[model samples]
Target: EDGSAAWLRYAPLPHDSSHSSLPSSIITLNSTRGSPVYTAQQELRRGIQGIFGKTLNNGTSSNQHGAIIVGTAQAYQKSYGEFDDAKELEEDGYFLSSESNQVLIIGQNERGALYGSFDYLSRLAQGKLGAVSYVSNPHASIRWTNEWDNMDGSIERGYAGPSIFFENGFVTDNVTRVAEYARLLASIRINGMIVNNVNANATLLSPRNINGLGRLADAMRPYGVQLGISLNFASPQTFGGLSTFDPLDPAVDAWWANITNQIYARVPDMAGYLVKANSEGQPGPLTYNRTLAEGANMFARAAKPHGGIVMFRAFVYDNHINESNWKADRANAAVEFFQDLDGKFDDNVVVQIKYGPIDFQVREPVSPLFSTLRNTSTAIELQVTQEYLGQQTHLVYLAPLWKEILEFDMKADNRSSKVKDIISGERFRRPLGGSAGVVNVGTNTTWLGSHLSMSNLYAYGLLAWDPALGAEELLQDWIRLTFGHDKKVIETVTEMSMKSWPAYENYTGNLGIQTLTDILYTHFGPNPATMDNNGWGQWTRADKFSIGMDRTVKNGTGNAGQYPSEVAKVYESIETTPDNLLLWFHHVNYTHRLKSGKTVIQHFYDSHYEGAATAQDLVEQWNSLEGRIDVERFEHVLFRQKYQAGHALVWRDSINQFYYNLSEIKDEAGRVGNHPYRIEAEKMTLDGYRSYSVNPFHTASGAKAIV
Candidate 1:
């Protein structure tokens, strides 16, 4: 499959399949003209054709066998009687059931039907559709993605080459790639997308570009996807040709109203605006000494007229005061900024909170902002791009990390207070209009840039839809859909992906010092030496005998107080906290003993040596499947795996050598710092990104540079 189709890859099932016992009758309750409900009708027909080699009907039929009935809950209430009502469904949710004879998928709205459609296909594809006998209401209402691609075709933090929606300096006229991307998102029940980078350029909202966006909106319409765009905070002056861009200014409000009108004129159901304000030199209401709410509320006012919402990012920080302490905690900024202004937001504005306090690190505690934003709606942001997780080269499925963040209980004011329930509006019972916005950018034909990596994207969607789903279950489902029905392929790739996070953890940062790498602009490759120097909090605090940042309240950065009483009490003490996150919130010595009964330095030595060794095992494992998969895909992944294996050794050796030098501790195995061999200049083929100049689309050389 080569990962091109993502989870939507629907190969025709063999004739011997027994799902043929499904009923022949298909029916629709109440349908609309080309709405999301209509899209579900269309998709159901397409999926049935691929799966059973039979066409499904849109109108009612006497034969209830294999019949699929879909409608809004209201329509079903009027006709078939909703087993659940609006109050019961909490405004928007879905109820679905299908068996040997009758099948019904009803949503509270058209979009929900579309979601139900994809959920049904996933079940069938995973061979679990026949087992479902329950109605499901989603916990989180906002499932979204942010495409950090500029109209000039450059994708920020994107390893997959340029923006698929952009070529040259303008939006692409060739939109085939854009439509396919929409299908991939819709299959995962992703309902919203911001079409540009957070470092938004004012030029994107110009008439010509909005026209291009209209075309994209139309293509994505059938797939039940809505297009949102990032708004430059100074758009009032820059985009509208105004004298000032102040949120309180009447002119600024009028300018935004005009812009929103112009956008909706072409694509009436445009999702909304995503604003990155007061961060990274971006303009914001803070320039006027107004709260962040003022900046978001201004756009929220404009969007309210059109039934849209404004997603204001909570990822704000300035390194201006960064020189003050040995540890400047960037991880505490979000809650510090937004917690006090919780109830100040307009109804149509959702505070887009990053999962962790710091940027998308390999491992971080859940951001306290999710609990702090009580009145304001919130959407959790995640990055599917493996910026720090070895770029796209290493196979890392991020659902495990995401699951931890989503399921983290903040115990806000109530006991069942988790970040997921908070953002979902379930725990706090507030209105949550925004969804999860993931950063997954790559230009490889597969979209995410790798065959195995598609599982992360797939799992992100499933978990966003239903946060309660097990990470391993989601991984297994993705393995089946993306790679097909091969047992060996399923088992090997699944085992590898599940173990990948821990493996990456072992070699990179034993106790959360973080994968020591340079983080000035791009976050990639091993340079644990540079981890402490960057403006980030990755400092090991290493000296003669000590290592790690001390984030405890009594003797350190006082960041532990950010958590609720429950988590804070546990994390504040070194003995009670998990060993995996030791260095993250605490600064200890090499002599410190972990709960596992191993010394801190020994854990580092063992994990790096073991992790690198496991990477070699990964290559051997994948090599065993040489003839079992598509040769092109198998060989491509094998090449990358082999490279990662070698690179893992580099990570192991570099980290081992760095720590051993610092701690002056020897490996328990007596060979922690041993080098397998150093290659001569002629023997080392690691041209790295220098060799990647092949794809002109990706190369420093330009778009004509494919090797």
Candidate 2:
């Protein structure tokens, strides 16, 4: 199954393991046939059989000595007595404990029991199957994964393989993989998944597609995973034969209501609709001169009747930014778009704001819109796909980045307000809030592009459930579950994953300039030369003397002014801006000194060299554990590690040479643009590079030296 089972591969525990007073029977309460309760009961049986080499009997009526009892709070209250702690649990919270050799996995609802079941199984896999007691509740109401999968079986911005939901422009009949995917998601407490690209097609709303969605829903129902869709806002005109898809138009409203009713009719437990409107040429209410709130409220109104939500994306920006105009900035788009319409949206509409103001940059300031939209529901959108952070080819653990975003203080209302509080509906006391991650999984055997990349998927769910969980700790849990509890394997994989994100950022983009990849291509290679004279709103603004966008309020785009007073002042001046994001806010000279007392150009050189060196060390670390895990996964990870090591050198040299060329400066270490195997400028044509005779940095090198 080549990594397809993911972290659910329940290999047997070590025969000589300590604390092996395992449960003798699996017990359940009020477990109706074909319900989530029954599914959980079956899962525990299957998992215990795989781990313990014994099939435990179902002892619901029998008072077995070492029985694992799993059920809802009501079921437990009916079977035993009322549990006082059961009242403490929220809607999806669970209570797990072991007292007097009896284990209890209880949920406020059936879904929580499933989560508790998985947690108990995870502990068993991690060799912690002993006495324990805890009440686990997710901080956020909605923990969702949005897949950017198209109906054509292609995944947009996807480095993994094709889509698992669709094939040849239609839903695949065999959904065995979908069931497995649901199991994987349920294990991580991921309740909902929007399975299509936000840039949607009209065909997704057709009768055939609706039936297919029902099939998918049926497949996922046992695991308690709800299905959602990304709607094409222009569906009224494109699919309903209406003239104008205006939110204010009664005909358009009727069309949406009809569609919503159809969707809910087919799949009773359909999650909701995710809308990306008036952004990047997607048809939106803006076309009809309607406000974004008006655009979103229509969908919300239609879904409200069915108890569904309308997740309106706040990624609205003019891709063709007037960059020649210095004051024009795309970073201000979301704040400007929804700041005034804060109270205008329906209660069921949640504004899904990206973690950063701009697109998913390697390093970026938290989005100001998060604090500004005080009256509307909001959800912090994160990308687990690694689109700008090495696209899963590079081993980048994203939990650290997400933790920073969730932990940032917004200073709303002249007081401290952390982002996690705001998104969890605690800060504003709003009706709804949560986190949404753009998942990178596909039909690839490894789930992601590589086995190591699965950490991002695992960590996203864990962090969404509890943002306070440390990235390193989450990685440890994932490592134990996926590869068993070998000390060497756990330590080695954790170190590599923990170091990966920082190494990737260091080599690709220092001082938060964002990765200098080619904007037109797949965004995979160094192309600093294309930063200027482009309208993607991602400008480096690198001229002969200085680099970076001057976004301070005084002399530039005034984007810093978007933040609250306390945060605004810090970013408004170069002295207070953090060194990591210095270049993101202010344009600086090549000779300008950072807080670390190094020149901007020198920092670039040193960071890239160090990062590349660290990437090679990752290969070494993985090589040291060659025999620690299964040969298949070990070899697969080794192949990726070797590729990443080689590619890191390419990232290092190309970025170093690009900046060196732009500034016409030599590295203080004499490493940049001074490689011993350098190719001359004349021999560094694109054709020569394509032919593998010249390095991408255009330095003199052997044909075989090119990655």
Q: Best TM-score goes to which candidate?
A: 2
lDDT of 2 by residue, 470-587 (tens): 9999999899888888899899989998888889998888797988776655677666766666777888889878998899999989999999899999999999999898988999
Ten contiguous residues minimizing lDDT sum, candidate 2: 698-707
Candidate 1, poorest ten consecutive residues by summed lDDT: 695-704
lDDT of 1 by residue, 520-596 (tens): 55566666655555564445667769888778888887788888888888789998778878988888889899988
What is the Cα-based lDDT of residue 165 in candidate 2? 94
Candidate 1 matches the true fold with a TM-score of 0.91
**How many Å off is the CA of 223 in candidate 1?**
1.8
Would you give me the overall lDDT of model 2?
A: 0.86
Output the lDDT of residue 189, model 2.
92
Candidate 1 deviant stretches above 4 angstroms: 28-33, 57-66, 74-92, 129-132, 536-538, 676-707
